[model samples]
Target: MAIVLGLRVLGIDFDDEERIERIESAFPAVSFVRLNGWTIAELHLECFPEKAFHEATDLIHQLGAYGELEFVEVVPHLVNTSDIAKLTGVTRQAVNKWVTHPDLGFPAETDFVGGGHARQKIWSLYTVNEWLSEVMGIDLGLELPPMNLVKQVDGYLALEGDPLLDGAKDFHASGL
Candidate 1:
Protein backbone atom coordinates (compact mmCIF):
# COMPACT_ATOMS: atom_id res chain seq x y z
CA MET A 1 0.00 0.00 0.00
CA ALA A 2 1.22 3.47 -0.79
CA ILE A 3 1.39 5.70 2.27
CA VAL A 4 1.59 9.44 2.47
CA LEU A 5 4.96 10.79 3.56
CA GLY A 6 6.13 14.33 4.24
CA LEU A 7 9.74 15.11 3.29
CA ARG A 8 11.13 18.15 5.09
CA VAL A 9 13.70 19.89 2.89
CA LEU A 10 15.77 22.88 3.91
CA GLY A 11 17.79 25.54 2.05
CA ILE A 12 15.98 25.24 -1.30
CA ASP A 13 15.86 28.51 -3.21
CA PHE A 14 12.54 29.00 -4.99
CA ASP A 15 13.23 32.52 -6.22
CA ASP A 16 12.70 31.59 -9.87
CA GLU A 17 8.99 31.51 -10.51
CA GLU A 18 9.48 29.68 -13.82
CA ARG A 19 11.60 27.03 -12.15
CA ILE A 20 8.94 26.55 -9.48
CA GLU A 21 6.30 26.12 -12.16
CA ARG A 22 8.44 23.64 -14.05
CA ILE A 23 9.11 21.64 -10.90
CA GLU A 24 5.44 21.50 -10.09
CA SER A 25 4.61 20.47 -13.63
CA ALA A 26 7.28 17.81 -13.70
CA PHE A 27 6.59 16.23 -10.33
CA PRO A 28 2.83 16.42 -10.14
CA ALA A 29 2.71 13.72 -7.47
CA VAL A 30 4.67 15.80 -4.96
CA SER A 31 3.08 18.82 -3.32
CA PHE A 32 5.45 21.39 -1.87
CA VAL A 33 4.55 23.68 1.01
CA ARG A 34 6.88 26.36 2.35
CA LEU A 35 7.04 25.91 6.10
CA ASN A 36 9.26 28.81 7.12
CA GLY A 37 9.74 31.36 4.38
CA TRP A 38 11.21 30.18 1.06
CA THR A 39 14.12 28.07 2.20
CA ILE A 40 12.32 25.39 4.21
CA ALA A 41 9.64 23.31 2.50
CA GLU A 42 7.69 20.15 3.22
CA LEU A 43 7.12 17.91 0.20
CA HIS A 44 4.09 15.68 0.58
CA LEU A 45 3.84 12.59 -1.58
CA GLU A 46 2.71 8.98 -1.51
CA CYS A 47 4.91 5.94 -1.93
CA PHE A 48 5.16 2.38 -0.67
CA PRO A 49 6.72 2.07 2.79
CA GLU A 50 9.70 0.09 1.59
CA LYS A 51 10.50 2.66 -1.07
CA ALA A 52 10.38 5.72 1.17
CA PHE A 53 14.14 6.20 1.38
CA HIS A 54 14.66 5.79 -2.36
CA GLU A 55 11.70 8.01 -3.09
CA ALA A 56 12.99 10.70 -0.72
CA THR A 57 16.48 10.51 -2.19
CA ASP A 58 15.13 10.83 -5.73
CA LEU A 59 13.07 13.84 -4.68
CA ILE A 60 16.04 15.51 -3.04
CA HIS A 61 18.08 14.97 -6.17
CA GLN A 62 15.37 16.33 -8.40
CA LEU A 63 14.94 19.41 -6.24
CA GLY A 64 18.70 19.77 -6.04
CA ALA A 65 18.73 20.27 -9.80
CA TYR A 66 16.83 23.52 -9.22
CA GLY A 67 18.62 24.77 -6.07
CA GLU A 68 20.80 23.73 -3.20
CA LEU A 69 19.69 20.74 -1.11
CA GLU A 70 20.99 21.28 2.42
CA PHE A 71 18.93 18.71 4.34
CA VAL A 72 16.09 16.26 3.95
CA GLU A 73 14.23 14.07 6.43
CA VAL A 74 10.94 12.29 6.86
CA VAL A 75 8.52 14.34 8.91
CA PRO A 76 6.43 12.24 11.27
CA HIS A 77 2.74 12.87 11.44
CA LEU A 78 1.72 14.36 14.80
CA VAL A 79 -1.69 14.32 16.40
CA ASN A 80 -3.51 15.41 19.54
CA THR A 81 -6.27 13.60 21.47
CA SER A 82 -8.97 15.00 19.26
CA ASP A 83 -7.05 14.01 16.17
CA ILE A 84 -6.57 10.51 17.58
CA ALA A 85 -10.25 10.19 18.22
CA LYS A 86 -11.07 11.26 14.71
CA LEU A 87 -8.45 8.99 13.18
CA THR A 88 -9.54 5.96 15.21
CA GLY A 89 -13.26 6.61 14.91
CA VAL A 90 -13.60 6.81 18.69
CA THR A 91 -15.07 9.44 20.97
CA ARG A 92 -12.93 12.03 22.73
CA GLN A 93 -14.02 10.63 26.12
CA ALA A 94 -12.73 7.18 25.19
CA VAL A 95 -9.33 8.54 24.22
CA ASN A 96 -9.17 10.60 27.42
CA LYS A 97 -9.94 7.58 29.55
CA TRP A 98 -7.35 5.51 27.75
CA VAL A 99 -4.65 8.12 28.40
CA THR A 100 -5.61 8.46 32.07
CA HIS A 101 -5.57 4.72 32.58
CA PRO A 102 -2.04 3.39 32.45
CA ASP A 103 -3.22 -0.19 32.32
CA LEU A 104 -4.49 0.47 28.81
CA GLY A 105 -0.86 1.01 27.80
CA PHE A 106 -1.50 3.93 25.50
CA PRO A 107 1.68 5.51 24.21
CA ALA A 108 2.96 8.49 26.17
CA GLU A 109 2.54 11.95 24.74
CA THR A 110 5.67 13.08 22.88
CA ASP A 111 5.26 16.68 24.04
CA PHE A 112 2.96 19.23 25.56
CA VAL A 113 2.07 22.59 24.13
CA GLY A 114 0.50 25.70 25.68
CA GLY A 115 -0.58 25.75 29.36
CA GLY A 116 -3.61 25.29 31.62
CA HIS A 117 -6.90 24.92 29.78
CA ALA A 118 -5.29 25.61 26.48
CA ARG A 119 -2.73 22.82 26.99
CA GLN A 120 -2.63 20.00 24.48
CA LYS A 121 -0.72 16.73 24.42
CA ILE A 122 0.98 15.62 21.21
CA TRP A 123 1.72 12.06 20.14
CA SER A 124 3.43 10.60 17.12
CA LEU A 125 0.85 9.20 14.77
CA TYR A 126 3.10 6.20 14.19
CA THR A 127 3.17 5.21 17.88
CA VAL A 128 -0.53 5.80 18.27
CA ASN A 129 -1.27 3.59 15.27
CA GLU A 130 0.99 0.87 16.63
CA TRP A 131 -0.78 0.94 19.98
CA LEU A 132 -4.16 0.85 18.32
CA SER A 133 -3.11 -2.19 16.29
CA GLU A 134 -1.38 -4.17 19.07
CA VAL A 135 -3.37 -3.39 22.21
CA MET A 136 -6.82 -2.52 20.91
CA GLY A 137 -6.85 -4.99 17.98
CA ILE A 138 -7.80 -2.17 15.63
CA ASP A 139 -6.19 -1.62 12.26
CA LEU A 140 -6.71 1.81 10.88
CA GLY A 141 -5.15 0.72 7.56
CA LEU A 142 -2.44 3.33 7.89
CA GLU A 143 1.04 2.10 7.00
CA LEU A 144 3.82 4.32 8.35
CA PRO A 145 7.53 3.76 7.78
CA PRO A 146 9.24 2.42 10.90
CA MET A 147 11.08 4.91 13.10
CA ASN A 148 14.32 2.98 12.85
CA LEU A 149 14.21 3.16 9.07
CA VAL A 150 13.33 6.83 9.25
CA LYS A 151 16.30 7.52 11.53
CA GLN A 152 18.65 5.54 9.32
CA VAL A 153 17.54 7.38 6.22
CA ASP A 154 17.79 10.71 8.02
CA GLY A 155 21.31 10.00 9.26
CA TYR A 156 22.48 8.91 5.84
CA LEU A 157 21.01 12.01 4.21
CA ALA A 158 22.52 14.29 6.85
CA LEU A 159 25.96 12.86 6.15
CA GLU A 160 25.52 13.47 2.40
CA GLY A 161 26.02 17.23 2.68
CA ASP A 162 29.32 17.17 0.80
CA PRO A 163 27.88 15.86 -2.45
CA LEU A 164 24.95 18.26 -2.29
CA LEU A 165 27.30 21.15 -1.53
CA ASP A 166 29.46 20.13 -4.47
CA GLY A 167 26.43 20.20 -6.74
CA ALA A 168 25.53 23.66 -5.48
CA LYS A 169 29.08 24.83 -6.11
CA ASP A 170 28.94 23.50 -9.68
CA PHE A 171 25.57 25.17 -10.25
CA HIS A 172 27.00 28.51 -9.16
CA ALA A 173 30.25 28.01 -11.07
CA SER A 174 28.40 27.48 -14.33
CA GLY A 175 27.05 31.04 -14.02
CA LEU A 176 23.60 29.93 -15.08
Candidate 2:
Protein backbone atom coordinates (compact mmCIF):
# COMPACT_ATOMS: atom_id res chain seq x y z
CA MET A 1 0.00 0.00 0.00
CA ALA A 2 1.05 3.59 -0.60
CA ILE A 3 0.80 6.04 2.29
CA VAL A 4 1.09 9.78 1.82
CA LEU A 5 1.43 12.32 4.60
CA GLY A 6 0.49 15.82 3.50
CA LEU A 7 2.31 18.36 5.66
CA ARG A 8 1.24 21.99 5.91
CA VAL A 9 4.23 23.70 7.44
CA LEU A 10 3.26 26.71 9.52
CA GLY A 11 4.90 30.14 10.02
CA ILE A 12 6.99 29.86 6.84
CA ASP A 13 6.65 31.80 3.64
CA PHE A 14 4.93 29.63 1.05
CA ASP A 15 7.32 31.00 -1.57
CA ASP A 16 10.36 29.67 0.29
CA GLU A 17 11.42 27.01 -2.17
CA GLU A 18 14.91 26.84 -0.68
CA ARG A 19 13.59 25.86 2.73
CA ILE A 20 11.40 23.17 1.20
CA GLU A 21 14.39 22.00 -0.82
CA ARG A 22 16.42 21.73 2.37
CA ILE A 23 13.77 19.55 3.99
CA GLU A 24 13.54 17.36 0.89
CA SER A 25 17.32 17.09 0.80
CA ALA A 26 17.39 15.91 4.41
CA PHE A 27 15.16 12.96 3.56
CA PRO A 28 16.40 11.52 0.29
CA ALA A 29 14.27 8.39 0.60
CA VAL A 30 10.90 10.14 0.94
CA SER A 31 9.24 11.29 -2.27
CA PHE A 32 7.84 14.78 -1.72
CA VAL A 33 5.33 16.35 -4.08
CA ARG A 34 4.52 20.06 -3.91
CA LEU A 35 0.83 21.01 -3.71
CA ASN A 36 -0.40 24.61 -3.30
CA GLY A 37 1.55 25.20 -0.05
CA TRP A 38 1.58 21.64 1.26
CA THR A 39 4.36 19.09 0.92
CA ILE A 40 3.03 15.58 0.29
CA ALA A 41 5.56 12.88 1.17
CA GLU A 42 4.74 9.44 -0.19
CA LEU A 43 5.93 6.16 1.29
CA HIS A 44 5.35 2.83 -0.43
CA LEU A 45 5.08 0.05 2.07
CA GLU A 46 5.64 -3.66 1.40
CA CYS A 47 6.36 -5.31 4.72
CA PHE A 48 7.48 -4.69 8.29
CA PRO A 49 5.11 -2.20 9.90
CA GLU A 50 7.57 -1.35 12.66
CA LYS A 51 10.24 -0.26 10.18
CA ALA A 52 7.78 2.02 8.41
CA PHE A 53 6.64 3.47 11.74
CA HIS A 54 10.22 4.22 12.74
CA GLU A 55 10.97 5.86 9.41
CA ALA A 56 7.86 8.03 9.71
CA THR A 57 8.75 9.03 13.28
CA ASP A 58 12.28 9.96 12.26
CA LEU A 59 11.06 12.03 9.32
CA ILE A 60 8.43 13.79 11.50
CA HIS A 61 11.10 14.73 14.04
CA GLN A 62 13.37 16.09 11.34
CA LEU A 63 10.47 18.03 9.86
CA GLY A 64 9.36 19.29 13.29
CA ALA A 65 12.80 20.78 13.93
CA TYR A 66 12.51 22.86 10.77
CA GLY A 67 8.97 24.14 11.35
CA GLU A 68 5.56 23.19 12.70
CA LEU A 69 4.30 20.50 10.38
CA GLU A 70 0.51 20.42 10.58
CA PHE A 71 -1.04 17.21 9.34
CA VAL A 72 -3.09 17.91 6.27
CA GLU A 73 -4.63 14.61 5.25
CA VAL A 74 -3.47 11.12 4.36
CA VAL A 75 -4.23 10.90 0.67
CA PRO A 76 -6.15 7.69 -0.04
CA HIS A 77 -5.90 8.12 -3.78
CA LEU A 78 -6.64 10.59 -6.55
CA VAL A 79 -10.14 10.73 -8.03
CA ASN A 80 -11.34 12.46 -11.14
CA THR A 81 -14.56 14.41 -11.87
CA SER A 82 -16.63 11.37 -12.86
CA ASP A 83 -15.82 9.58 -9.63
CA ILE A 84 -16.92 12.61 -7.66
CA ALA A 85 -20.14 12.91 -9.62
CA LYS A 86 -20.95 9.28 -8.95
CA LEU A 87 -20.20 9.65 -5.26
CA THR A 88 -22.31 12.79 -4.90
CA GLY A 89 -25.18 11.46 -7.07
CA VAL A 90 -24.74 14.31 -9.52
CA THR A 91 -24.22 14.43 -13.24
CA ARG A 92 -20.71 14.79 -14.66
CA GLN A 93 -21.71 17.99 -16.44
CA ALA A 94 -23.05 19.37 -13.16
CA VAL A 95 -19.74 18.57 -11.49
CA ASN A 96 -17.90 20.31 -14.30
CA LYS A 97 -20.17 23.32 -14.05
CA TRP A 98 -19.70 23.46 -10.30
CA VAL A 99 -15.94 23.46 -10.75
CA THR A 100 -15.88 26.05 -13.52
CA HIS A 101 -18.62 28.38 -12.32
CA PRO A 102 -17.42 31.37 -10.33
CA ASP A 103 -18.95 31.93 -6.84
CA LEU A 104 -19.45 28.17 -6.48
CA GLY A 105 -16.62 28.01 -3.95
CA PHE A 106 -15.50 24.66 -5.26
CA PRO A 107 -12.03 23.44 -4.36
CA ALA A 108 -9.33 24.01 -6.93
CA GLU A 109 -8.46 21.01 -9.03
CA THR A 110 -5.21 19.24 -8.24
CA ASP A 111 -4.55 19.08 -11.97
CA PHE A 112 -6.39 20.32 -15.03
CA VAL A 113 -5.77 20.81 -18.73
CA GLY A 114 -6.66 24.15 -20.21
CA GLY A 115 -6.90 25.89 -23.59
CA GLY A 116 -8.72 23.72 -26.15
CA HIS A 117 -7.82 20.48 -24.45
CA ALA A 118 -10.40 18.64 -22.36
CA ARG A 119 -9.98 19.34 -18.65
CA GLN A 120 -8.87 16.36 -16.57
CA LYS A 121 -9.54 17.59 -13.07
CA ILE A 122 -8.58 15.64 -9.98
CA TRP A 123 -9.00 16.10 -6.21
CA SER A 124 -8.56 14.34 -2.87
CA LEU A 125 -11.58 13.23 -0.82
CA TYR A 126 -10.70 15.58 2.03
CA THR A 127 -10.78 18.59 -0.27
CA VAL A 128 -14.13 17.53 -1.67
CA ASN A 129 -15.69 16.93 1.76
CA GLU A 130 -14.50 20.26 3.11
CA TRP A 131 -15.89 22.04 0.06
CA LEU A 132 -19.20 20.17 0.20
CA SER A 133 -19.76 20.98 3.83
CA GLU A 134 -18.41 24.50 4.02
CA VAL A 135 -19.49 25.82 0.62
CA MET A 136 -22.29 23.68 -0.74
CA GLY A 137 -23.78 23.10 2.70
CA ILE A 138 -24.03 19.37 2.04
CA ASP A 139 -23.23 17.21 5.00
CA LEU A 140 -21.73 13.85 4.01
CA GLY A 141 -22.36 12.33 7.45
CA LEU A 142 -18.63 11.92 7.99
CA GLU A 143 -17.57 12.53 11.56
CA LEU A 144 -14.43 14.56 11.14
CA PRO A 145 -12.91 17.00 13.57
CA PRO A 146 -12.69 20.67 12.68
CA MET A 147 -9.64 21.75 10.68
CA ASN A 148 -8.32 23.80 13.57
CA LEU A 149 -8.43 20.85 15.96
CA VAL A 150 -6.72 18.57 13.48
CA LYS A 151 -3.98 21.15 12.92
CA GLN A 152 -3.60 21.85 16.63
CA VAL A 153 -2.95 18.18 17.43
CA ASP A 154 -0.97 17.56 14.25
CA GLY A 155 -3.36 14.68 13.72
CA TYR A 156 -3.25 12.75 10.50
CA LEU A 157 -6.67 12.48 8.88
CA ALA A 158 -7.07 9.71 6.31
CA LEU A 159 -8.83 10.68 3.10
CA GLU A 160 -10.08 7.37 1.79
CA GLY A 161 -11.98 6.57 -1.37
CA ASP A 162 -15.02 4.33 -1.13
CA PRO A 163 -15.77 1.17 -3.14
CA LEU A 164 -17.82 3.26 -5.54
CA LEU A 165 -14.75 5.36 -6.21
CA ASP A 166 -12.58 2.28 -6.70
CA GLY A 167 -15.19 0.82 -9.05
CA ALA A 168 -15.28 4.06 -11.00
CA LYS A 169 -11.56 3.67 -11.70
CA ASP A 170 -12.26 0.16 -12.97
CA PHE A 171 -15.03 1.51 -15.16
CA HIS A 172 -12.55 3.93 -16.66
CA ALA A 173 -10.17 1.03 -17.26
CA SER A 174 -12.87 -0.99 -19.03
CA GLY A 175 -13.71 2.03 -21.19
CA LEU A 176 -17.22 2.28 -19.83
Best by TM-score: 1
lDDT of 2 by residue, 1-78 (tens): 333344444444556778656766776555566665455654433324434444444565566565455444544445
lDDT of model 1, residue 133: 90
**Worst lDDT 10-window in candidate 2:** 152-161
- lDDT (0-100) at residue 37 of candidate 2? 49
lDDT of 1 at 149: 52
Candidate 2: the clashing residue pairs are none
Worst 10 residues of 1 by lDDT: 167-176
State the C-alpha lDDT per candidate: 0.68, 0.55
